[model samples]
Target: MKFIDEAIIQVVAGKGGDGAASFRREKFIPKGGPSGGDGGHGGSIYAIADRNINTLVDYRFARLHRAKKGENGRGSDCYGKGADDIVLRMPVGTVITNAATGEAVADLERHEQKVLLAKGGAGGLGNLHFKSSTNRAPRQFTFGEPGEELELKLELKVLADVGLLGMPNAGKSTLIRAVSAARPKVADYPFTTMHPNLGMVRVDQNRSFVMADIPGLIEGAAEGAGLGHRFLKHLTRTRLLLHIVDMAPLDENIDPVREAKAIVKELGKYDESLYQKPRWLVLNKVDLLPENEREKICKKFIRSLGWKGKSFTISALSGEGCKALTYAIMEHLEQESGIGNEEQIT
Candidate 1:
């Protein structure tokens, strides 16, 4: 299925049914009373978060959505039938916003979460309701209220525990394939990954975490230099980030340290909070270097970049050091979750 992260659509609630106006009459009775009935309420529109859905492609083409109108009331004191509500199932991480007002209406983070989008119109009053002792023969009725309508913007941000960041063809897709069952398109050219791909990395039989791989970022990515502008939002939901750098650049003249710094700068420019997330540098494609020079090169790069945090050297293609990387991630996540649970209890 094609990946669609954003969509714009219009939603309209059903209109209420009209009230009935009639009078009761008999063969011999000279005076009769009003016997009209009230109208039925209109149908509403609701949105639900569905875990099974990962993309917004369903609402990409077809934009307009409307609920059924209520049935009209009949004479002889017969009430109209109310219309059924319409529910739209969206992805778990979908964010709904009001297009006209530019306000966020809802953020669906959990599965089966429901939110009301549009309210149905109220039913109108009948002539019988206006009849009283003073106005016994009153002929008054109110029209049904109109339903709510609005245009909405739907944005999907993938929910994941770990996110991978790197330059194009920096072995991100390759690493995900080696660690998990997710097999994204792999090639020798740049921009191989046009959309975000998610993979579940299971540390044990019962413990696992979700990982997301977005398109690579180039310099000035925050200024819409490349595809990064389209998918930078996906990184907001990740708890940890793995910054993969090419240890041995295919182009010898390009300095790996400068490239790493450029990537970091782009992150901060795109989102400050996102850039502040816990990130570990992973020097990839180490197999291209000799065994004796691996440590020396890694240390040199780290020192030049003044990186104080944790770092790892691995070959994403050969699966060397991949197990250690994944195990470390599992431990970090476990500790974080444990702390969260304790805070909740307190």
Candidate 2:
């Protein structure tokens, strides 16, 4: 299925049924009173979150949704039938916003979460309700009320514990595949991953965390360069970030250190809070380097960059040093008091 993270749609609730204006004319009773019944209420519109869905691709083709209208009232004290409510199922972690007011209406984070988008109109009164002692043979009925309509914007942000950040072809996809069950497209060229992919990385028998592999960031990613800000917003929900750098670059034109610095700068420019998140430096493709020089090269890069936090050297392709990296991530995630705690994190 094609990945679609954003969508726009219009929702309309059902209208109420009209009242009847009639009087009973029985054979035995010559002076019969009004016998019109009340009208039924209209159907409402609702949005529900489904964990099975991962994208907003369904809304891409169908943008408009409307509920059925209530049936009109009939004579002889017959009430109209109420319309059925319309329910729209969306992916978990969907943020709904009102297009006209530019306000966030709801953020569905849990499975089976539901929110009311539009309300149906109330039913109108029938002629029998207006028949009183003074007005016995009255023929007064009211029309049905109109339903509410609005335009909405839906945006999906993947829920994860760790987010992978790197330049194009930095072995992020490979690392995720090696650690988790996710099978993203892999190739020698850049921009092979155009959408975000999520996987569950298990550190131990009972301990595990979700990881998200976002699209590669370019030098001017903060300024909407290359793939732009669509993928950058996905990192906001992550508790930790892993900066993947190509230790042995296939292209002689690319500088690993320079590319790493550019990515950091872009991240700070986009959101300062992103820089404050717990981060780890990962050097990938170490298998391509000479065995004796790998340790020395890794130390030299760390010192040159003036990095004080944790760092790891691994080969994502050969799965060398992947277990240690996963354990380190699990340790870091557990150290933070509320990082993985369900009650505190949301």
Candidate 3:
């Protein structure tokens, strides 16, 4: 299935029914008084978060959504029935906003979460409600109000504990495959991953975390080389970031340190908060270097980049140093969360 994360839609709530005015005229005791029933309320529109749904493709095709109108009131004290409500199921990470006013409406993080998108109008009043001593035979009835309508924009941001950041073909996909069961297409080319891919890495029996891999970010990406928002939006939902640097690029002319710096610069330009998130450096493809020079080369690159944070040297394809990396990530996430390490996310 093609992954679609963005969509726009229009929602219209049902209109309320009109009130009724009547008089009781039976074959018994002359005039009894007003005997009108109230109108039923209109149907409302609601949204629910479904974990089973990972894409917004369905909403892309069906852009307009409307609810049913309520029934009108009858004359012989017969109250009308209210219409059923409409529920829209969307992905768990979906965020809904008012397209016109740029106001945020909802951020669905948990499964089975529901929020109201449009409110239904209230029911109209009946003539029986206006009965009094002076106006016993009154013929007053209030009209129902109109339902609410809105244009909304839905954006899905994938939720993960860790996110991978790097240049094109920096071994992110290979690293994810080594750590988890996700098998994203890998090739000897750039932009192999056009969409985001998620993998679940388990360190122990019950200890696991989700990792996300997005398309490679280039030097001019923030200005327009790529849709800056689309590329970096998924990282905002992550708790940690892994900056994967290709310690051994196939092209001898390419500077790994320069490419790494460019990647971080683009990240900061896209979102400052995302740039401020906890990040660790992973020098990938150490197998390409000689075992004796591995430590020296990795140390030199980290030093030249002025990086003083957590660092690791790993061969993403050979599974070397992958286990230690996953364990460290699991520990960091657990420590930051201040909870048990057994809770799993979908």
Specify the poorest-scoring 10-residue window by lDDT in model 1: 335-344
Question: Which residue pairs come into collision in candidate 3?
Answer: none
User: Ranking by lDDT, best first?
Assistant: 1, 3, 2
Cα RMSD for candidates in order: 2.1, 3.1, 2.9
Off by over 4 Å in 1: 28-30, 339-346
Per-residue lDDT for 28-121 in model 3, tens only? 9589898888888989999999999999999999999998777777787877788889999999999999999989999999999999999988
lDDT of 2 by residue, 140-224 (tens): 9987787889899999988999999999999999999999999999999988999999999998898899999998999988888
How would you encode candidate 1's per-residue C-alpha lDDT over 1-346 as one tens digit per residue? 9999999999999898888787878788656788778888899999999999999999999799998777777666888888899999999999999999989989999999999999989878778898898988767776677789999999999999999998998999999999999999999888999999999999889889999999999998999998977898999999999999989778889888998999999999999999999999999999999899889989999999999999988899999999999999988887888954675789
> TM-score ranking from best to worst?
1, 3, 2
Candidate topping lDDT: 1
lDDT (Cα atoms) of all candidates against the true structure? 0.91, 0.90, 0.90
Which is the winner by lDDT between candidate 1 and candidate 2? Answer: 1
Sequence-dependent TM-score of model 1: 0.96
User: Model 1 Cα displacement at 64 (Å)?
Assistant: 0.1
**Could you give me the TM-score of model 2 versus the true structure?**
0.91
